[model samples]
Target: MTRPAAPSQFDDPWQAQVFALTVALSDAGHFPWTDWAQAFGATLKRHGANRALDGGADYFNAWLETLESLLEQRGLAGQAEARTIRAAWEQAYLSTPHGQPVKLPA
Candidate 1:
């Protein structure tokens, strides 16, 4: 039987969240949209050189990478902090029961 679809436009919740965050940051003038576009395009090109991009996780992963890099360069967040946050999210995701909203541990 086919699985039920998620109530989201993107394939994964994280994808949607990241997309929104990027747009919000751009809207807030944290970075120029043109810069974001150029950086994202470069990231896509580098990732695509390794293998095919299915416009799913691969696309979002590249998007996330570009955002992280931009934030790092702007001194908003460093790589170590990003890795720590990522690890926390991963742990939260893994610990949450299936079909329930994941929340970071207090």
Candidate 2:
């Protein structure tokens, strides 16, 4: 019998996008990769306390959280702004018609 293919590194496009963004930020000298690894590890530990991380949404959520916290610590972006943007995206996603692109307000 043929073996099944290995799963993709990310379950969703957003996860991949976040991963790329993190790498880009680190490469740009915003912070060192070691710092990113440390923060991401801590976030995983904290979030993993409640549930199993399947390297899917749960993992990426923790990753996104770590990135956001790091950015805030470095004075790059505020948590409030992140929340606002998330809310806006959520609203846009909910209001948009199925099979259409979701657009955020200017």
Candidate 3:
């Protein structure tokens, strides 16, 4: 199966780093989309539109940093280990087959 095109910022190296971090945290059970969306919305509220746009990358980076800390605190993964796992997960998700359900390891 084909993967969708990576989002615009995702094409950038630094942006891809943050994106990978976020995806990794999600996979590691740090926080689900509902929790993330709420946090993101709260961030937007505190920052307002202009700053949100201008500093969005920094915001995402901060979010990722926080996620890593949370994961470590919960004993889910250490920071370096999480980075390795995240990289593997990013490659697998973006390259694997589609249109058929695949069993994921727990």
TM-score to true structure, per model: 0.75, 0.78, 0.42
lDDT of 2 by residue, 9-106 (tens): 77789998999999999999999999998999999999889877776688899998899899999999999999999899999999999999889977
- C-alpha local distance difference test of each model: 0.91, 0.89, 0.65
Top of the candidates by lDDT: 1
Report the Cα RMSD per candidate: 5.5, 3.6, 10.6
Positional deviation of 61 in candidate 2, in angstroms?
1.8
Model 3, residue 81: C-alpha shift (Å): 16
Q: State the weakest 10-residue window (summed lDDT) of model 2.
A: 1-10
- Candidate 3 residues lying further than 4 Å off, grouped into runs, are 1-7, 49-106
**Ranking according to TM-score, highest score first:** 2, 1, 3
lDDT tens readout by residue for model 3, 27-60 = 7876787876766666556656455444446666
User: Residue-wise lDDT of candidate 1 within 1-106, one digit each (tens)?
Assistant: 3444764368889898999999999999999999999999999999999787877788999999999999999998898998998899999999999999999888
Q: How does model 1 score by TM-score?
A: 0.75
Q: Give the residue spans of candidate 2 off by over 4 A.
A: 1-7, 50-52, 97-101
